[model samples]
Target: MRAALLCSAAGSLLLSTLTAAPATEDRTGAAEMRGTAVAAARAKAAGVDFGPCPDAQDLPGRMQCGTVSVPLDYARPDGKRIELSVSRARATRKDPRRGAHTVPRQGALLYSPGGPGATGLYFPLIGLLPEWKRIAAAYDLVGYAPRGVGRSAPLSCTDPKRFFNGPSPAPTHPSEAYKRERVAQAKAYARGCAERAGDALRHYHSLNNARDLDVVRAALGEERLTFMGSSYGTYPAALYATLFPAHVRRMVFDSVVHPDPARIWYRNSLAQSPAFERRWADFRAWIARHDDVYGLGGTAWEVLRGYERASAKLAAEPAGGKVGPGQLQGAFLQAGYYDDQWPHRAHALSAYLKGDAKPLVEQMEQHPEAAVEAENSRAVYVAVECNDAPWPTDFRVWDRDNTRLARVAPFETWHNVWTNLPCAYWRVPRQRPLDVAAGPGELPPTLILAAERDAATPYEGALELHDRLAGSVLVTERDAGTHGLAGGPNACVNGHMEAYLLQGRLPGRHAECAPHAEPKPTAPGSRAVGRSR
Candidate 1:
């Protein structure tokens, strides 16, 4: 995971630039409390608490780990509750240069680490980075595992090994047999979830996640919220902003998700197929430019043929009796998310074609813990996405559309289909996506960042979100493709991001950031890294 995607506690503000926000009355007691008959269904109810964090002795000030709780269903606040694993780090240091105890704390920043399922108790670890050091002095940092995530009443369908290590149908061009297998797999997976989790799956959607944010805010005794979310995290952050606009002090959404009616998620994922194909070309082209070093191909087409050949060989005889065609493609998929890893992935591919499979096998992340993490992330992803909105229940609608998309964009169309097909058979009833525009209190201006060629979340999604949230500013990285833009290599994007969080000031209605140069190959003494315009 990118450390940048995980933010920590807030810190000292550039006093000259920081603006203090007004206090809003705490609304903890504002929401009506209901009956207690359902209390038996819950584990212990919890409040925000902080204490020593292990293995973080070197951290500035101190890092704390604790627990908070939210109802499984907000409609019944006093009902069955689930625990939230939370971490905190306060940037409440005194500075004499300004004045002793002169800087009042800026509101703590609540961070979401991209995965709707990603465990975020590690959010404060981002403070380990030098870039966030100055930013950390302004406020406390808060991190949590949302409901149904790790350490937060986690939901699992079956023996995770079956879901993680089980054989998968070829994601490449699939036949009717392959399609049937996938449909069955998806159905079984959904059924397993129901058997294991029961009605709990219904509460795993984003609206509830947003609702839980309020419980967290009230627990912290803060009147307002200052939030930063990345990737899928953007979805919930936007929901929190719209559903509770008055409580928002500031927000930053990086690599925005487009949850509009036309392509919110079902269609949105289909779009990623083509986007990944385009990004694959970028990776292929880069490899072609360094043909002499890799000896794989002299052009993008040639490089692709090398990949196809490798996939065929792997499919016939799994590399090291483990990595198959599915593993091969999965290894390369990382290039679509972060270009910085391109050189590394390409080298792995190169080594594989030359009859050495070590590098390629490593990309599969063979560690026992890696499989566990992947399974949990996948479970949460399916639970949240399927429960969030409606999907055509008919497998034919999914197959027909994905087949059409695969004809033109074959890189990940079917692969993505199988990954999300579980949604079609999802047992939970779906709701319409919430209107992410301003709430009744009216939202303040927000800052949104997008890479021009983000494969996971297209740049246009950011533009769409900019339109949805009135007064929000949009920052574009002209030619980049990384998934999380803020706290990335782009200094310009981070400048605007830090300023917004620190000063609560909005940049221009639209801002443009130049993409940094593609990374130089890391082959020994190959070349010194250079910056691109």
Candidate 2:
């Protein structure tokens, strides 16, 4: 997931200082010149109305939606304008007291969940994060879909069918044929999206996103902005501090990504495959301990063998007559992202072992949009990733590195490589990824949170980011799941975040939190959970 930050600054920097801006736009008659291939997309998308989502429960405050205009290119202050859609929940408790600081209007806390395509506008309904609400009470809690994502000028193909509808073909191992074929597919996907997105696709880089955040800050009427970022949002927030440090106030970055310019944003996922396997073993061991329940195996090794057998079975005769590698991988990927879903996975797997295929099939089809979401996610993902840094153009280099990594991380090696296949067709060539060097010149003192076992954003990445940010105080969860471990009911993790949000206190000297325990499962005959989010 990603976090969001805001920054307010003077008008754009000139050409010499504008070296970092992602694109250049012609200024004359720019408003009338919507002459890009995406004109049809923009036009068709325009009619799809998104009415303001009213908070029906009357929880505490009201939410308002508005648009902020930013330059298409930050280097040219007088350049064409791009609209950024934003929403805000005004402070619930407003103080009327002595002039100035006593009266609250400090600023807004903007948030994003870090997909190059993940929607940030739904923060209010995400019950998992209660800490976000607490912060909203004091400061306006605002969220916006970044460019090329969600309601703010979405990025999609003209005939965007379910991207992951078909079964995925599994590769035995990285071989010459596999490398060439997959590379071609990746390039094809990228080309399709580029042809689809047209000019809008070119502006989908992180630099533009960072500039968009600043525009949102200005529109919100904040003199300076506070930030709370996680995962990919950390990259944009960090960029804001560097490009315009003086505008930053207090900030928090959770599950930060490295901003080194040399790194390939998409290729980076390639390196993470083996790491995911390491965590998968931990998961298997946990499952094997309950062998009587799952019956996969009594040992982790046996469990892996069982999985291989199941996968092979499905490969030979597709499950439920339709299930494929895409569905299986999607189910497996869910467990990798968060530990809370482990039971759900266990239930599906156990049922499958018992020759009951419905549960497993249902789980795989839980979110058909998941695959499409994965695709669109990859589009925005590559737009930002490719622009962030240069990737090795040589197929041999990628093949060699992936081949080496697959030796150990075979489970996700091919899966990840295929996931990023679109990068080969990305419209923009490699640009320097931000070198995230946080210092006195950038960012205020920040609070950073990380779960020890988070596979997506590993703990080491958090520690490294913490080291870079001079004002950052790191809170380490001894054993936890997923990236955003805060705002949950965990007293240790939640309490630390609460204090940071309400009282601005950090845990002294890198405090540790107890691992989270999964909620006990309900028996078949137990009363039903009427509804769930």
Candidate 3:
């Protein structure tokens, strides 16, 4: 799995120079240039037959499910087709009017939720929220599991335990032997994926994912698409827009990724280090504010010292024989992702420091059977990211970069490197990433959201995308650090998102919204705000 995707605890703001525009005509001219592929795809999509979802009783709302058969290799549409599982909740209001801009009731509002491996089948549930009810009422809320993900011929490596439950990426010390072990493990992981997934691995790149989206668009009988994507999900969403510019109606890319061709996976992971460090400082300050309740420390530095001490102690003697230093770090990493998780994480740490291990132990424990599912996610994450672009081949290059980064951003630098180390040994051939830059008047107005201090996909990435995509509006959540800004706690961000989705309104120019207030100390026995990421 891409470490950047997994490091997201929960899951940014800015404005570009671009402005909103009227929807463009479907680029039938471009479609014609693609020759018979477009017609063939349309014919196949017309034949799709939707039925009751597999777990209709379990899923929310009136969620119907179906599958569309797309070619494993789009170049050969008639050959080796793969079924992509799709779910939909039809719009409630047949006609939704917003001001003078009444949205025509057509096409589905498709969404991709970050993780290259995250299943989108359940994402339509977001449409049920009161704030998003208007959107659901105007368009079908659509979600689909990308190829190699859940229910879509899910791929996996041979050894589940060996891949998931192995040594921590960040060892306390980087000895020569440890480096060798990591290298061997990475090679083994790469070999396992190639041996297990075979030719399927080659077809799992982001381009194929974009192509798959078009097939879904054709199947839905819609001329254009409206999309919302976050984290790694933004890459595919943007790529789809680039490939089929005229087919895009509206797009929301939150916590945007920098689509730098040279730094696709490797350098992107490195960029998160400093961003995570900034978030870590913010978390420490929050803990200090509640020192009276948790008794961890009275200053940010003090709180950090306490955490380091506790981590070292756990490294020596793990709590409840399970929550070691690595597990402790993993649990606390959530705090940097979302402010809502701070209280719970602080309470857990306080309890562990006072010799109670239940909270820490419970947080780290996983069901034994979940390893298979985890490996499946990992398999897809690796396939898409590794196949999308090249990673450094030399272990020494990675070691050098990580070692330098760990000096200042120790929180996630080394761990992130190991999380992505397998890419260096990937068996699939790398393809040059698509040029994601959109020419002037080529794409519909896009809303780009970014936090000032996002850790997973840094704030700078949002700026990069804003500059590249012409006619896009950038919305910044000033000083906020959470990932996946839209549908989050901030009404300011969500308001703009809803406006664009419902009425196709873009901010006049670049804009910024105030961050939500941080949580205060709660009385003992009262529940915390709970996890937000």
Candidate 4:
């Protein structure tokens, strides 16, 4: 999920001075189909041509992979089409428990890994983990590359090497000049995407993604949608349920996007700025507590000073030349998502200050080939975000809003703004934001999880989504801030999730999980997701 956003920028310092299409082409009349509805009622869903999965050898069940073709434009239904890569980890049996359960296991659990851009063809592989055991037993875990992501008509905006691996500007204080630079690069990137993507940009937003998702569901021959998605993935999943509510059996949205139509995406993206700032504060405070281990600072302010000094050193002479100031900040961003990363990253910073550049440099390494995938992720992220709804055409609105926000909560504010700045110059028609509150028919009980302190999809979203979707359950992870709560460290949350998926009901409509333990000094854990550029 971190990689979904962190790497989607595709370029670290992409800036210049400052950084949408029309109606009538009516492809978004495609959106008139509701994010992913098949406007042509008679259009038959394509069948998936299942074959052996390349990476399924390690899993217990026979994992199958195939491609399903869907309409490139739902409005044009049968006129043209695109492919979606699909995977299925077949459900072998129900829970072989010593516990008594009478309800029959339900249908496939269509899964997306939280990216409006993240590659998800392999998500079914999560069933191999112990945490997913009962889930795997009760349902066929279905995974697919949502439209314009990964192998499914993937979007590409610019040359990968230049956009992803090129040098970034110094992470110095934002001056007028620095702000102008970001604007220029943002325009350049947006223009590049429009020039490169052309007509294809019109078909990649959430509505079309939703339309394609239902086509995939039909291809799998499922009568109802039982789904699980994280972060931005929840947006389309919610749309699918709304677009085709009668077909919705069950759903689990982990770290969800708010669906008030008012928050569509621009406001949603901006909301993350402050959340990241608070999470960063938590990391700094954690560093302060572990001063005995890190010896960098005894207070949060002192710790931030240590980081600033390190950022300055890296800006002048990048550790190992590859890990620059951008790389340093990228490393710090990980602590905003997962607290367990605090110790290792803090140590890496400490080592860099002591002249052990290898720790930080190695932490920031990237294989050259990865740049292409990063470009695809970024392209889809840009296309979807920009195309999902209208953005401020006037750069001043962007400039004012971001400037006001950054002044108070500086962490990630500018970096995040530049990443999505392409939206201001989008080349395709922007759809009216999808209304995900209700479906054509009654919606099923949904399980939405969010950590109170989660920066990616803030707790407000979960609360809002719970309010909009009547009878849905909202589970809070108290005092914790991690994203992607399903199968996470909190057993209480996981327990609620597992019980919901397997038995189709939770103990209560509203629940909360206590915070998971924080990490010990130097404890090895999850790696930082994505990197600078």
Full-model lDDT for every candidate: 0.73, 0.62, 0.76, 0.75
Model 2 earns a TM-score of: 0.82
Per-residue lDDT tens digits for candidate 1, residues 445-480, read 889989988998877689888888888999999988
List, residue by residue over 304-403, the lDDT tens digit for candidate 2: 8877776777778777877765577667775776665666676677677668777668767534555555556666776776565545455555565566
Models 1 onward score TM values of 0.87, 0.82, 0.89, 0.89
lDDT of 3 by residue, 1-533 (tens): 23343333211000111111221113232332263255446645575576788988887647888987777876555568788899888877643345445545656888876678888888778766666777777888888898998899888866777644521333644788888887997898789889988987787888778778877777877777898888888988888878888889899999998886655766677778878888999999888988899888989999888888888887777777656777777767766777777877788778878877777676665546788777888788888887887677777777766776667678887667666788888877776676788989999999999998888888878888898899999999998898888787788998999889888898966989999777776544556775334
Cα lDDT of candidate 1 equals 0.73
In model 2, residue pairs whose N, Cα or C atoms come closer than 3 Å (at least 3 residues apart or on different chains), thus clashing, are: 2-113, 2-114, 3-229, 3-230, 186-421, 259-434, 261-433, 388-433
Give candidate 1 regions above 4 Å deviation. Answer: 1-47, 53-61, 92-104, 166-169, 439-441, 524-533
Against the true structure, candidate 2 has what lDDT? 0.62
Tally clashing residue pairs in candidate 2.
Answer: 8
- Which prediction has the highest lDDT against the true structure? 3
Superposed Cα deviation of residue 407, candidate 3 (Å): 0.6
* lDDT at residue 342 of model 1 (Cα atoms): 78
